[model samples]
Target: MEMSEIQAARLLLGGDGRAGQAASRQVGQESASVRYGEVKSVDAEAGTMTVLLDGQSQEITLTDSTASTRLKAGDRVKIVKQGQSWVIDLAGGISRALDTAVSEANARMGAHDETMAQQQAAIEAAQAELAGMDRKISDAVDTAISQLETPDGGNHIYAGADEPTPPKDGLKAGDLWYQTNASGQIAAVKVWNGTVWNGYDMVANSILVAGSVGSTLIADGAVTTAKITAKAITADQIAANTITGAEIRADSVDVNEIASGDIYCKRLTATDGAGYTEMTGNKLEMLDSGSRSLVAIWVEGGVCYINANLAEKISIGTNSGSVLNISNGGFIFSSMMPGFRVNGVSAVESFAIAPGSATESFSANVPYSPHKTSYAVVYYRCTYTDTAGSVKFPITEGGSANVVLKELTAFEAADESIALGCAENITVALGNSPNKTFAITRGNPYRFAIKPSGNSVNANPGSQFEITQVTLCGQ
Candidate 1:
């Protein structure tokens, strides 16, 4: 038979069968020291191999005794040193070692996963505890804010240094207490009537006993006029003669309150006997010892009489109206005097005269006694044409334009010739006419005449000369 390659390699090494076998056994033992590497190169015919050991390339001779001849580049293999030569083999042993390493790595990964889960659970627990703490803190803050006495909470009433404590409970209707009012000031005693507290002033409610002399309840000057009701005090309440002249206000007493016959005197005459004597009657009279009444006041009738001549003149009415003026020498009634009645019949004659033509003359007969002094006032209006003409109008009492009379002589003589008075003349311009009035006093039968100035007295046609209204007043 042909000798195997291993036997031929042993003969060349000069080894007999037994010695070769023994040497082979020793090589195999040495080759059992295995390490993992990668095959870098392989040459099957040369029986040479290059393997990477410890990150370095190493040459290996593949003898016939080598186990695998199918090694190729990039193949994981097991390398062993055998008697000054390296041997390359299939990576069976390496594969077994890798399986063990894989098992250890998987165990470590499982442990890491367990640790991460535990850490996550701890984080979640910490978050939950933090949230609970936050809620507790918020509740505590809310409780503190609610207890404050600000505008958002309780208003107006808060205990201060000088203020009273606010009532908290046990409230009843009309129960009295104290608190701050709406004005933020300490109020007077306030009453509670189920719903709200009502404030009241204490001083205004207190009452004082009448006739109590020395009571300290009311302060000095505290009682004013506003506090007293109308007619609160009567005469019975006031002490006798307690009010003085200084205490009584001016004009406090009315005239109606005084009793009649309160004023009296012993005599009207002075001690020097220069005044008149007082006389007793229904009238208040002052007289001389000769029993002649000098002055008298009729108290019941409200009339006054003077027997003696008065030093000053008396004026009865104002200047604008009828005036009955009495002087030392005489008395006169002015224009517009209302006539006196005789036996309830109208004694005075009044005329509402219409305007006459300027060319005509007008006349009126007045009831006048020739022996008695009488007065007449004439009011006339004259209208003229637009021409340069002058007109003189004369007011005649009798037929003549001029009549003379002495007033004192007329009254003394009582003769008609002495009583008849003169006529007065008033001139008017035709260009600018105006109203005129005049007053005359006479004691005669009178006929008033209005005539033009010239003998051939003719007014301009359609021109008006009139006595609109005439009042004849006498006393």
Candidate 2:
């Protein structure tokens, strides 16, 4: 039974009902108790409640039911007595309590559902916005790629072409096309410089100098920028220093010029075919093919005169002589025909036999048996005369009249003394004589007599003597 507070309060305070005594003193504790099964209809206006117990319903009075003393269905009512009418029940007590709980639970569920719906809508909106932005970004990328044109008539992409397909010419997506020299080598790179397309450095490869593998020659390029030089130029030096040794070897230099030490060729022969003197300064001159004269000179005369000009100097000794004869004994002779003499006295000397013409053949073995048998040998000696005058001697056969000196003995003994016997001090000396002297008379028969002088003089002119043959006896 549901009971109103007014009815229960009247029962407890006034002791007006049968159950009043039972409920009265119990009020000092907390709320009064009611039997749930005994509840009947609540009467909110009468402030009392009826309850059924033991199959019978009754009206029980209560002291107070709360302020206005009204009750209704759904209110939580209580029966404070054993017999209480439905009017004494609390007003709408059970119903009101159950409604409040149901309302509160519905409100919370509604709030949670509303909040979850909002979150879902927000997520959907964000996804749609992101999809639209992706489309715009993709459109911008396409515009950028279309603006660029590669050398092979293709577009350029940042990372790569769409779908990463190779270019139509099988080139990389961002790659440019250019011509190469059949070696599959990159001739040059034509790339974009942010504003325009331009070619990077393009240069022709170099060739080695002929016959020189390590040497190099550039066909064309700016030497200052191309970095060309001789082998002596180190790699680091080439990079650091200015480029030099820049030349085009169209034709070789003259061999004569090279042989004469006029020009230098680094990697060419000294006698190159193009007349080039492949002479190089501070470097070696090498042949293109065969061997060559490394350090040689070409002489043009009949004799190769390397040192000073001693053309007419004779090599005279006790065993050798000059090729030509001088007028006087003490002189140096030459080999030229009708030769000349240097540093010789030529006052009155005559040829052994008159020359083939004015020129005498001082060649070997063309005269009478000469004391100096060799054509080159002749004797030299000085003489002192007691008369203090010059002497004269004839290089002829010694005889009284018609005489023939077959040997040296005949020539020595055939000396006819037609002069006075002056003295041993009165001497007749012999100078360089190619042929043996048959007769010699120093003085005239009317003056001082002749004498034999043992003094000696050099026949070779410069400090030497020569004897071709030895003759012991005078004819």
Candidate 3:
């Protein structure tokens, strides 16, 4: 027999015996009961409400509970809805349910907003961290590129400084260096002098580059004018005479005491045989003056050489004995000569044999010998060393440095191998006249003698010959 507040309101408001009717009508109907009235008086201590209706005021008893709403004398409110009954408004069960639902909804909204805010903050933090890492990685890559870009040229020392040389293939602010990578790439290059890292750094090592052919270490485009020693010159590096970035000007260069234009400057001080010879050019200002007699001549391609007033021809191979024997008539004359003989001051010199002498030609031809063929010979004694040697001048196996004399006694006619041979000693003999006295010795100057074997009438036409001087290491 528990009654809801709506039932109680029905009992209080519906006529005393009309409860059953109100309840029956409200069973399936969605409705509420309300009354219009004015508050006449309120008693705080008694917790009661006195409302006026139709000029009459009635005192109402309030529930003894803290959750109930208190009304003042002039305030107005509605009671809870009841079963088909009209009643005055006041705080009741309906008000409590609404209050609870509104409070729960507000708490849930606050919690949801806080979670969303936290998630947004986390996303922003992650983005900032990623940006910082990107910056660090970029900086690291830039540093690596700079380190790799450093040059690897040979080292150059300053005038008066005591700093240790930089790594051969590493970065250097001031020093001379030339180094390459495994692929023959120019990895690092540096040259340091007294003041700055420019101009005075382009001094060549030995008038030649130390890299292999097609290596690109000292190719044509690698050198420029700013790296030359002379600061006032219009152009410093000659691309045509390309070395490395350290190429010097052709006009201002000297190699082994021989100037660029084959002009003799002084006695060459080298680890091999050294001497000087004057060469007159048939064409004035030829690319090669043919004077220095060094293998590395600065001659342009497709140039012609005309030896005017030259007599006798001497042509020989690079691999053969030195005895160039020419026999006919009565004796055998050999062209095997010595090491150092003054070119113009030798008793035996090469000259074109004049025609007409048949039975008695000058270097007497042995009768019924090896035909009337002409011959030119050079004596050679090879010595090799294996100690401290240069690439161009390699050491031999004896551990006592020496030279290689590829013997070429007979002259070739055309397109012959143009390489030279080195010689330190030579021996000769003439099987002819009863008093054939030809002396041979070392250290004494000598030059190859060019002579024809057959009679002057039927000599080898165009008796051309070549005699290469073998320069020894530590000579």
* Whole-model Cα lDDT of every candidate shown, in order: 0.44, 0.37, 0.37
Q: Estimate each model's TM-score.
A: 0.22, 0.19, 0.19
lDDT score at residue 228, model 2, on the 0-100 scale: 39
lDDT of 2: 0.37
Give me the overall lDDT of model 1: 0.44
| Candidate 3 vs. true structure, TM-score | 0.19
Count of clashing residue pairs in every prediction: 1, 80, 49
Residues 335-413, candidate 2, lDDT per residue (tens digit)? 3233322224232122332112111112222234343221221222212111111112222233212211111111132
User: Among these predicted structures, which one has the highest TM-score?
Assistant: 1
Residue 327 in model 2: shift from native, Å?
Answer: 99
Q: What CA root-mean-square deviation does each model show from the true structure?
A: 36.6, 34.9, 32.8
Clashing pairs in 1: 359-459
| Residues 1-475 of candidate 1: C-alpha lDDT, one tens digit per residue | 4344454334323233234363653333332355565666776776656544443332333453343466567767765556744455455745765887899999999999999999999999999999999999967754453233435432323222233334475444544444545663555656555677676445644456565543524555444222333744554234332333333443234333434454455665544565666657866666665656666655555655544433355556875565665554344344333323433333233222332432234443434423211233344333321112111122323322232311111222333232211222432111111222222322222222222321222322222433334343323
